[model samples]
Target: MAGKQVMLVGVDDSERSFYALQWTLDHFFHSPSASPFKLVVVHAKSIPISAISLGGPGAVDILSLVEKDLKSTAERVTEKTKEACKKKGVEVEVDVTEGDARNVMCDAVEKHHASVLVLGSHGYGVFKRAVLGSVSDYCSHHAHCSVMIVKKPMAKN
Candidate 1:
């Protein structure tokens, strides 16, 4: 007998990310064979408060405010992901971390012993991806487990 497999998904407050979450539930979690599995939804907070703090006293106050807002948002997104998964009859654990998305996700894969790491792509072009640095692209290359980059499905007529 084998142990439960873990599936880690990167979540955010984006339509693309929700679509990926749904796709993951439908594609992987729905099957009977996929039992004895655990799903982990993670949101990373990469706030650049260190840079903001370099400005002085006023900047320190602003940095604290920004950090608070970011933490609030991260909690909300994690709750949303948990609710969505619950509705799909899938159980999941949520993790909110402070770091770059790529590194955070990769670390989670290792920490959770994930069998697959799932996330969504924003469908950015080559130039945009180069400039913005795609998290999915980075995780696909770096994750310890197999990776699945789900794209938003187009609406049919």
Candidate 2:
């Protein structure tokens, strides 16, 4: 399966995601003969109705705003992903979709036929994770492929 794809890397604007992206490139792309896997960096941002409504009073205008924001976010994430890939000397294709993050991420994995999903572990305290239902947790239980949660090492003083 030298040319078979295997992994999808999900990225938000969070710092944790940067670390995860770095880890994935470092660990997975080192094998010269490995399959030419793809890296899909996604940024799923919710478009606030209030922000969109400022331009008009109709669904059409609101939808326009949402579309614009989605495109912009996608561009930004793609640029960042490209830069990261360049730094690692790896080539990857990026896909950015708009929707609920958990839903979009899972969908992307299936669409790409990914064998694994890589993501960062947000170091939410037990209480916070319990109360908010962390994204990593959601993906862990819901993703079709295997999930790898990369945790940032605590800085030592």
* TM per prediction: 0.89, 0.80
Candidate 2 has a TM-score of: 0.80
Residue range 72-97, candidate 1, lDDT tens digits: 88878988897888777787789888
Clashing pairs in 2: none
Candidate 2: segments with Cα more than 4 A from true spot: 1-3, 32-36, 49-71
What does candidate 2's lDDT look like per residue over 1-157, in tens digits? Answer: 4457768888887789989998888888876346477566656665566655565457676787777876776778778889988877776777767677888888888888888899898899999999976878899999998999999999999
Candidate 1 all-Cα RMSD: 2.3
- lDDT of each model, Cα atoms only? 0.85, 0.80
Candidate 2 RMSD to the real structure: 3.2
